[model samples]
Target chain A: MTQTSLTLCCKVLCVESDDDKPLASPADSLALIAQERANLERDLTPDPRWMFWPWGFAWLLGFGLFFLRFGPDGRVFVDLPEWLPLTVLSLSFIAAGLITGIAGGRSAMQTRGPSSRQGLMYGLTWSIAFTGMGILFAQYGDALPDDRLGLLWAGGMVALTGALHMAGGAIWNDRQLFILGAWTSVINVAGILVGPGWHSLIVALGGGLGMILAGLLGWLRLR
Target chain B: MSDGTELDPVIHAQARLRVVSALSVLREEDKVTFPRLQESLRMTAGNLSVHLRKLEDAGYVEVTKTHQGRTPATFVRLTRRGRLAFEEYQEALRALLNPTSPSTSSEETL
Candidate 1:
């Protein structure tokens, strides 16, 4: 038989062998399989720095939103300039973006993979969604009572964030993120039910605490 | 049909098979660092270096040496030829396992 035909015949025989065993010696094949499994586990494990971005973002954005709504006296902190708050909020987002981008880039380079693209896309989509939501609120906000409108916007934003996190968790198979998303959704809904006055505090405590807890868990796992 | 003799000897070795198998899981463009490979295989650095050198000499694997910050890093990847050879080896192995089958008899007649 020609070399090519012989190889083809061997390939046909290999089909069943590939499914049943990798090598004639069962023990050696098992060891090789175990080693490969370990390698995969290592690849899927996330770095601690990855968890920091969300933690920092939650704390920064939560504090910024809370401060924007009310000061220590349960009243608006600064009525002097609307532009100033918007600028601050924008700056906070920019900082969060930088943190995530730099850390994610480093991690991807180390791993040599395309996994980081998913995270970048997720962040980009969410940013666009938030901008669109803001425009919608501005257009229709006057129809609702001022207090009710604020509650609706705040609750909606939190719920959107929660849903995003849940989706990310499901896609990535991360149970912690899934739980955090569910926790945030429930807390924001409860806050809305409690009354419009409590919206800022609920978000501040819920979002901030949830992110902190998740970050801590991730850090501990890395250790 | 029972051409077990056709298996690539380079990849049939247990250690080499393990290395190739680990690398086969990665994307074609991806390269795994030496330390990572060593950790995954639970092999000594010197032993892995020796195995890697053999694979590289045979043109079954490509090794790149570069610096990560001040430290030197070695990256390894399977070549296209290596992947094909491994697949063929698996096929040959399967043929060897099923020597008494009808397909083997037909090939033997041919």
Candidate 2:
């Protein structure tokens, strides 16, 4: 139907509440059903988390880690100690975690469908899987070359993140998130094939751009 | 004649039907705020209040008025009775729409 017609139908449907009025014609009933379905679709759309503060910090974390790993011309840009980047990365994660926890807690209090506990479970699972992978890599570090080790780490992180996103998206039935997860998964495989030297760059450019774009889209939607 | 008559008049009205339909999709404990419901239904505050009062009077919906800091917020959720009434209304509507169908007779027996 034309937008004008739909709006007129919706307006009619919204205004008619009198019990004394004649029963709605089949066409009118159909229109009301259509309008109701549209409203439900609009309402059930998930909150725009990409616009949240933690997401912005997540982008920073990706870029910061990339810069730390590659460095500028083999020299640190800020000439900081080797441990400083790790410290910064850890701090960013803590900040993101805190923000997510606060936001999720507030959201859970307001809405009953999306449970904060479910989100915490997802996060805990990811952390455990990541730590297990790290231990395995450490144990096999001597068997692999230094360059290949970096590739494995980067690829593993990307794959893990993509898998989690895909899982969450599937559970929530969010198409945007599912597509993002698929895009990241594709990029992860492609980055690994390029080998170590360029893997970080690919991830930084691809993943960072993806996140920024998603954030911008979410912001626009909110506006 | 009884087919259409079986429908719940409280839910059969378009505005109230929309309200109950929206609330039905939400989790049982979830509450929709007044502004959100108004926007979704594209109705004026006064008009929504009237319909909400009717539903509240019928014991189909529970309306809560509370303060968020300095601002007052109105939240609404369907009661269990409300959900059941909505389901029965839907069944009656289907029967009315398909009076000649065998399935309608089977549904009516249930």
Candidate 3:
């Protein structure tokens, strides 16, 4: 009836394996059950190493390039053409997106039911959310002062990215993803407060590098 | 020694229990490939095949030989009955651990 009495019961009910090896106490047996479950979860879940790094490098190179072309107060650190930085940034994200999509699709290839469906639905959410954000930005682009235009575009995208990452983390119970999102959101705000060019530097160093670090941790864990 | 209830013999063995517990983590409809199951359990193919055969015969698991692309593969999943039996086995284990554990209290209340 009490904990002590229950432990006595456990001692008596020791499960013996085929070779007559006495299993431990009932509490220990329960612990083993938990251990097995944990082991299975580790083996069964999709690996995140493939997803994190691509996005990390995308931000690192993309925003790093942007910082070079769009330094504060109309001071261009690198005299690269206006089209070059944005083009390179866009290409980087496109490449990352493709990598993410392919990796996700391959992982889900054999899986069906809600898990696979959730992956597809979540992927759509990212694309649709960005498209909607882009559309709204275009409609309101002319209303902002010419100088503030860049801040809205660059800072706004980073914020949206952070918010989405947090949302994904919430759904999946992924602490790393959520923290990265929060980190991105914070740096995005820091970038905007400092005005143009500086925003690129902050996001490039803060969000981009943070992602690479998280991805590195994930890679280490996989290994 | 048990408190009148016994664990299902089919799952009492350590190797089979490991297999069942691992498969139990997935949704009832979800299945694990034979290689994947073997990998997770770290059991040799022959040994796993024997245990799985026992489970299949007991109606606790279903084993299917199928093709993924051109390669031959086997998949396994717990049947609904098997899942229920596993739950009962866990309850039986708890009962053995403590005859008066809280799980029995609801029915024992008089």
Number of the predicted model whose TM-score against the real structure is largest: 3
For model 1, how does the per-residue alpha-carbon lDDT over B3-22 read when each residue is reduced to its tens digit? 23445657666788888877
What is the TM-score, restricted to chain A, for candidate 2? 0.63
lDDT of 3: 0.76
Model 2's DockQ score: 0.17
DockQ of each: 0.20, 0.17, 0.27
Pairs clashing within candidate 1: none
Candidate 1 vs candidate 3, TM-score winner: 3
Residue-by-residue lDDT tens digits, candidate 3, A1-223:
3433443443354543312433634455566666677666666555566687788888788888878887888788988888887888899899988988888776665444466677789889989988998898898777987558878888888998999889988987888889999999998988899988899889888988888888777656654
Prediction-by-prediction clash tally: 0, 0, 0
Model 1 earns a TM-score of 0.55
- Model 2 chain A: lowest-lDDT 10 consecutive positions: A1-10
| TM-score, ranked from best to worst | 3, 2, 1
Could you give candidate 1's per-residue lDDT for residues A79-133 as a string of tens digits?
6354554365557656766776666555455444344456567767777987888
Over the stretch B1-110, how does candidate 3's per-residue lDDT look in tens digits? Answer: 35222346687677777778888887767777788778878889999999999999999999988887899878888889889877866765676567676766643452
Task: Give the lDDT of residue A40 in candidate 1.
Answer: 47
Over the true interface residues, superposed, what is the Cα RMSD of model 3? Answer: 5.3
lDDT of 1 at A148: 70
How displaced is residue A119 in candidate 1, in Å? Answer: 4.4
